[model samples]
Target: MPRQTILGIESSANKVGVGIVTDDELIANTRATFHGAPGEGFRPTEVARHHQKILPELIEAALNQAGISESSDVTAIAYTRGPGMGAPLQAGAVAAQTLALSFGVPLVPVNHCVAHVEMGRSVTKSANPVVLYVSGGNTQILTYARNKYYILGETLDIAVGNCFDRLARVLKLPNEPSPGYSVEQEAKSGTKLFPLSYSVKGMDMSFSGILTQITAQGKKLMNGKDTRWSKADLCMSLQETVFAMLVETTERAISVANLNTVLIVGGVGCNKRLQEMMRIMCAERGAELGATDARYCIDNGAMVAHTAALMYQHGVHINPYSGADYTQRYRTDDVNVVWRNDVLT
Candidate 1:
């Protein structure tokens, strides 16, 4: 059989990514991000415009990187169809629709969260693992059973990454590389743990209070009120408090599911501290942990391409011109896993 190749578009947030993947290998992954100044956040309209401006060049670049002709190289077009900022999602969907029509190929619409998990599983080769999906806008424990990715537990309020980024904003941290990464770097010198609310209700967690308290403390620190507790201490404390909740919820899910493997996905999944904590928990339970490369952990077109390729190969598709629409509130469990059989374990 001839190798199958797919072009994927991902513009769910500030990042606009383009990727190409063959059946067995990833060929090219390109991305452009809209970076706001310190203490500033992304606006949907600006992000959408950024995507619109860069997508055409990015698509050409990705195709060029893959060493293929745009006319007849790709088998299908894939895109992050939902679970993202409305404007950004719409921009990517429209672009995907246009590209699919221009290329005369089937369009595969993919759920963003499921694409993350599928990419993790594909890269790590971890079959039927419990997934801890933590990102800027999401935090959930997921596992596959009966042909669906069941949500074991999730954030009841703000997501962990959002909390970190908000705190970073209060501290006037740079958003160049990433606010979370900056927080992590600053946390290395932290020696004291500040008191912050930890809201873990049964299995689900909440970070709203944590974020609020941390932001206040950060303001006070900026005003020279709490000189004893440095910014590093606050960052360290935030990570400790939040990641503990995540680990606890994930462990509970693991115990309940009786699964031996845990896979971490999404932007926050690239955090070294989080990965270490999950690994420690998995080790104690005599289980294994699965994680993708740091690059793949974050939102990218490759993951979307890989996932949509699986669905496209499995006969799942939608009309690019008419039926393809993006959703801002798409749930991970809402996607039907038609590509995989129900796992017995």
Candidate 2:
């Protein structure tokens, strides 16, 4: 088959992204993030409005970056269909449908989680590996089986990224770029690891308890109480505790899957500390660790484009203008892996 370009749209969170990917390579990627008020989280409607307002400019920028004409150069239009904020997903869906109709191309629906895993594999070239997917809204350890990726373990409560973001807001950290990034920097200077709750239920973990403990500490710090912990210490401790839990769960999952390679994906995967921890764990077990830089780790359009292209090539696609819907709770195990070889695929 001849190589073709795929254009993808991603508006799963505060960031709105667009990118172009060919059958073999990513050509362009562009994104614009919406900043929320300090100590506040983004509202769904507000995020959707942000995406709607900037999507056009982002698409144009991505096209220009790819050095291509409009939809004419794009062989398929792919958009994140579910497992995200409704309004934001709708924004991407609408834009994608419009592009598909305009260009007379097929509209491919891409699962957000599946896209992350697929992107990780594409970049790292890990043919088959246990995947640790972590982000602001999700955390799960997955591996491919029968016809889908099965979740071996996941967060029982809040996601690790959400925990970090909330803690950052409580500490009055700047939200520029990302709160997690700011926390990572402050943690570098931290010298102590404070005591906090660590909850692990079998293969699953709970972050709510840890978050509650940290929140109380943050309040005490704000009130000028002599809690014997600095904000940096708290940040560092939070990261260490949460990342340790993640690494442990991933280690177990790797053992269960008996896989020699591990791939970390999603927004929180950009954390260097997490990568380092994973490296150590992989080394201890004599396994390979596969991870990408911020470009592929964070939520972006390129991953969607790449995944959708693979699906399209394998004759796995959805009809254009048939149904344009998004969901807030799409699970990774629900999607069928039609692009990759499986007994069902």
Candidate 3:
């Protein structure tokens, strides 16, 4: 069997993930991180500007790292098509579509959230697990139903990961890496001393109030009766409060769905506490939990490439994406998921 190489480009957010994959096997993933020019978090227009400047170079680097000289070497070109900023999404779409045309191969447009879910299946080989996608731009509980990625529930407000990042910036955390990682790192040594809000309604959830409460809690700890509270304590409390909401909501979703397995996807799954907490919940309920390891958990080109190849192999693909537009509002229910079917190819 000839090797099928897929080139994946992910510029949905600050990190541009470029990867080459043969089916679900990863070849090389190169990430180019871009941050706000002068402030914190994302300045969409600024990221768009940065994308234009760095995208070409990053694409070249991905191809170089894959040791492929020409686009013709790739069996297919898969790119994240939507559920992100229009400018950023189009950036990768244009690049990928061009590569596909230059190689005269097929183009596969991947949904960012679905790609995240696919990462778990590629690794854990779980069947029929409830999916929890927590990322900067998305908060969704997905399961395949009636041939589509069914949306069990989602954020009525801000995304969990975005809420964390924004809260981190509010606490003056560094933007070098995401606040989720920072919060997790800080929680390691911090004692959770405050009680924060947790709201998970039905299968849906919200986190903005809790984030604000944590920030205020931190401020009170710094200036209140207990002025000696450690920063670790603050981070720990925040992590706990947030993780609790996630766990509670996911558990509720699992029970409602009547599924015995859970798959934790998206960048926020990088949190050890989240994994552990979810593990405990699944254990107590006698349900299996499928959470991708750090490498496969975070948003990377590998997931995008892996998902795109799967989409192509499943025959769920689009074409003429050279002028392919970006989708600022890509939802999980945008397309039906055709799992493990030969007709997909």
Candidate 4:
């Protein structure tokens, strides 16, 4: 199999990532984020259009970075098929399918969330335990059980990143470039004294109220109250509150699921404080945690490639036909990559 090379493309959100893998070595992992959710909130259709506008360039760049002369070197083409924007999924599907058709290789449809799990394993070297996926569109606690991945808890309203961005807007922080990064930087410098409030559900969480509380606090300062809103402090507070909820919820889920190892994925996982919280909690319980290592954290193409490489070993390769479909609402359980290859074949 010539070491089996897998090329992965991820366009599930505001980021466009491309990754390549040869055997266990990660050849290339690249991403381009379209800083779109600062002020204008997220519009799925708009984001999809943005992806469609740049799919070709990203795919080629990744290939070039991997030093591949042609598609023939690619053993499989992997892409995030669903649980993302319809338009963007279509664009990526078209790209993957085109490459598959041209190169005569299998087109592996990967679950975006599961890609996190795979990347987490690559980063942390864990053999499956638990996953905390907190991103712009999703907040979920998942674990593989009964031959299927189960969602232990999730958000009732908005995602964690969405809440952060909303709060950043209220604070009128630097919305340009990376708002999350900006908020974190501001929080490091912030020394204010405004406290945010919120509670975590048994396995679920609510971030909207937290958002409102911080917004109200910021508005009070605008009313000429004698206050010092150190952007860093507020950022620290907000991060503390949200990260605590996630850590508490994750701990509970771990206790109930009887799993110690926890893999934290998504953009929020990029937060050092959140990673530290999870690490400390896991250490207290004698459970290993997978949160650090920039490779798996945040949305990127390498995670996608890493997943394809593993699923290929598990025999999840399925070549799409000429009329194969790209789904918009695909469930994790619906696509059983582990043992579905023979059945479908």
**Per-model CA lDDT versus the true structure:** 0.90, 0.89, 0.77, 0.77
**Which of the two candidates, 1 or 3, achieves a greater TM-score against the reference?**
1
As for TM-score, the candidate ahead, 2 or 4, is 2
TM-score of the candidate numbered 2? 0.96
Residue-pair clashes, model 3: 7
Candidate 2 off by > 4 Å: 342-345
Query: Which residue runs does candidate 3 get wrong by more than 4 Å?
Result: 1-3, 37-39, 218-230, 340-345
Better of 1 and 2 by TM-score: 1
Cα lDDT of model 2 by residue, 1-345, tens digit? 877999999998898899899977789999989887667778989999999999999999999999997557788899998798888999999999888888888888889999999999989999999999999999999999876999999999889999989988888888878888888988999998899888877789999999999988988997888568998999999999999999999999988888899999998999999999999999999999999988888899998898889889888667676866678889999998877784421
Model 1 residue 343 distance off true place after TM-score fit, in angstroms: 3.7
**Which lDDT tens digits does candidate 3 get at residues 209-276?**
87777667666654664555566777777778767877888888887777889998888887888899
Ranking of candidates on TM-score, top first: 1, 2, 3, 4
TM per prediction = 0.98, 0.96, 0.89, 0.88
Can you rank all candidates by lDDT, best first?
A: 1, 2, 3, 4
CA shift of 63, model 3, Å: 2.3
State the displacement of the C-alpha of residue 78, model 2, in Å, after optimal TM-score superposition: 0.5
lDDT of 1: 0.90
Model 3: residue 86 alpha-carbon error in angstroms: 2.3
On TM-score, the stronger of 1 and 4 is 1
After superposition, the stretches of candidate 4 with alpha carbons farther than 4 Å from their true spots are 175-177, 219-230, 333-345
